[model samples]
Target chain A: MKDRLEIVASGFGGQGVVRLGQTLGEAAVKQGLRVTMLKSHGTEMRGGYVRSQVVLSQKAIDSPMCETPDVFLALSSSAYNRFKDTVPAEGIIVYDPAFVEEIDASLPCRQIAVPAKDIAVRNFKRPIFSNAVALGSLAKLLETMLEKNVVLESFLEVIPKYKDENRNAFEMGYETMNI
Target chain B: MKRFLETGNFAITEGAILGGCRFFCGYPITPATELAEAMSLRLPQVNGVYLQAEDECAAMHLCIGASLGGMKSMTATSGPGFILYADPYGWALGCEAPMVVMNSGRVGPVSGITGAPGQGEFYLTRYPTQGGNFETITLAPNSAQECLKIIVEAFYLSERLRMPITVLGDQLLTDGMEDISVPENDDEMKEMGLRVWPRLYHKGPDFYPASDALDIPPVQMGYDTGALCSDWTPTVEGYDIEEVEEHHKHAYRLIYKVRNNPQLYEDFYEKKYMDDDPDLVVVSYGTPSRVVNTAVERARSEGLKVGALRLINLWPFPDRHFSRKTKYLVVELNWDGQLVREVQRAAPKDAEVKFLGCCGDLPTIPDLMETFTKMLKNQPLERKGWVLEAW
Candidate 1:
């Protein structure tokens, strides 16, 4: 985190969008990076659109909310459509190809596709573990600022239980990313 | 020892435990509900009690009773629940029971949007109850770590002042997660004055006549349920008295305890960039101050002489933190200019006070930077003074 960088995970609620960002934030903090994660949820509990903006910096973070995210993780198609136009030109977009079908590549950002949900369902027999896969992919995109072990440790710290499958899903996602 | 990553609500609960809060009575509400949840889990580990009351009203009554029974107590709520608390809240003030309330305010009039952050309760915290010459101590924490630190202060001040103290945050701050640095040693926490003093578990009879303002040892309610703690005027000796002299002495004491002791209950504020002699100073409290920090830095990068002042303590309005020579901009997340009225009132007569307030949504740094830029150049504002939503 040179100046300040924000990573946003956007998806329909219950995809663990907030948890993905929260795990990253906690991992960043474990590395002594200043981090703030802002949770956004619709009034209705589950199935509604949800997003979380996690800002990390070497110094103190002034604003908790992120205007333009450096790394945008789209777990759903609606999530990809919502922020494609808003991401900065040099920013990167990481989307789950299994969920996000369409992408406007001309929007001036690097787009990387990962089969997060597919891998989670096939390997673990649980779609809920997609958040871990998504988080691991997000960490790959943020590798310059956060190490792979740091992200894995954060997942273990935050997940509370089911360490083995989450770890396998995370490793699969991490291996899928080229970064 | 390493500091843990915590949400604002969890940090408050952890800090309350460090502050020696032995009793927690609260009802569930969004944003603030986690504080109650955390308390239910953690209080028992510290040998404390956690009671989930039926409603905000009953929650506060239980809080009052717990504190009277001689344990540092607390409760948590949000916009609508905070309003429900006013009934018993007044008696807590009259009886001078030391209690801390953590209110994570949300967008509201009545059970409004639960996720959006709002500062509508800023003024409500000051005058929580009706018909009394009472003063409230309120602290607004901007981050998870500050949420922890500030709650400890809230509990400390409530005990020191013998009044209900409030820690005012918002949905953003409460739900927001961050790595918070805390004291490594419990001994350090005690040495730093985070310990509770009022463990009045079993004071003998005749403890009722003690003066709360004087910081005299208090009696347990189990000994005397009618410990002269009625909402009505009480005699200095701790009994109901409707007589003129007794009422005069009683009410004034309630007000003067905070007024005369600036050394004790004075406003706590944090000032930044004032030494740089900035042309414009932004005043804000709670989560809005985070945006002001960004705007201030952005303004400096753009070569504008701008600074920021964040109010950690909301009540007793720390006007003394202002530099009268500089133009001031007051920002908040409430419509109709409730806090700006205080900015206008407390700021020096010669100082120019500008208001840029928004409700239902947060004020962005770009908007603040643009407004401050216009104000700095003496340019006619596109909008100024209580910029309400276009009705």
Candidate 2:
């Protein structure tokens, strides 16, 4: 089997999709793995589809763009419906249960539904921290490339002002994963 | 060093510092104005001089003068500002002064959107600046990270080749944000041998001063009056009509010397892909080239024998590399097929050169793939405007 793992984090604008991909890429880099991150954003600043693809590999990354995603994270219903077909059959699809209600169960892929938004606003007191929560859960699932503490530290480095709330969000995400 | 988060503007400032740019002169233009603003704030800390000229013309002239004065100098501007500096830029090309100009292009024919990105200046850039045998080295960077690398290389190439170098970027690359690792000090820069700006003009007692007539000397603002000359004739001590032939010969020599020594091109792929026996070749440059490469790889996986050729240097056109074995040629550019004519001229007459063009300010990877996929299936290509159609 190939040692490369392709992860695509997609959601509406301001949902921190790009940041989540960047954090995972940074974590992989800290672990001595080659990483490439590609992101696309819409013209509008808010409420548009934002997606980022992160490729983690042991060898040099030949191309940064991802043709097929191994782990697909969809934070919005529109994003899930739009990109669900691009997910590989053997891959995993993670969705925010609060927003994404319907996922095609016919596709041969594992699914994980988590209350990512409610946990962020209620436990962390910041709805924006939901991205960090999603990222923490992703780090736990992709156990080979990243560690929970490493993702938490990367989040803290980027969001130093809200360290305690971010920590709580990370813990909630990690516990939700039940890893 | 303060660990504050840096934007693309500040990253360019850091690049200028690392590139040993001792002087900066510019007039404000959107997208590129931040580069000047950051230089004004940071250059003083490094003991470098920064000046705001009356306009882009004066800005480019000041930069050329500073470079001639044995200092590493630069300037920044957008499309409208770039048009104003055309005359002085031609002068710099004729004089072979080493300098760098960062053009953060925005939407424009005259003055379009100040904030949006545009690649409309592709043809203007490829056109010969001085109407002679000279070639200007232009580097198009796609991302902010490439912006820093290209700036450093631009300085090195300009000094080593003794010609004006341009870093062509759009509002996307210039205004976009990304994380980059800045070099610690100028030691790495010095090791690159780029700091040899004030080149030694003499060795021992037998000294020949650097002159604009023979040696292209560095001249300060208020230097010796004898060093300045606007006359077309070359005289030993002063201007004279009898030495007109000598001046023409010297100018031809400078132009031909640069034509002989072209800049280094980072061909995106190896010859295995661009070998003599390719079914079809898709040609692109800058960020779009990256997307084309991806599409080519995808097509290859599906059993389509296709290849791509990307140009790191748009000028000098790499005439030596084109061969007869190459088949269909498709030119993909952001402008309305600006570079297609040049590509057609460079290829064999029998070769069919097609244009897959766009002028939508920014062309995405998917858009390019869609167009390429259709072309590979033998579909007719779309033409953009009267200009491309005329060709």
- Cα-based lDDT for every prediction: 0.81, 0.67
> Which structure among the candidates has the greatest DockQ?
1
lDDT of 1 by residue, B213-284 (tens): 555444456654445567677665557767787777667867777776776644467777877778999999
**Runs with alpha carbons beyond 4 Å of true place in candidate 1:** B190-214, B222-226, B322-325, B383-391
**Model 1: pairs clashing at backbone N, Cα or C within 3 Å:** none
Residue A17 in model 1: shift from native, Å?
Answer: 1.1
Q: Over the stretch A1-179, how does candidate 2's per-residue lDDT look in tens digits?
A: 25778888888888988778877766776666766665555555678777777777886554455656888999999888887887788888889988798878887788888788989988767689898788778878887657777777877876677788778787788778854
Q: How would you encode candidate 1's per-residue C-alpha lDDT over A1-179 as one tens digit per residue?
A: 46899888898888888878878888888888898988877777888888888898888787887778888998788888987776898888999888898888678888998888998999989999998888878777788888999889888878879999989899888888886
Q: Please give the TM-score that candidate 1 achieves against the real structure.
A: 0.92
User: What CAPRI grade goes to candidate 1?
Assistant: medium
Retained true contacts (fraction), each candidate: 0.69, 0.02
Error of 1 at B275 (Å): 1.9
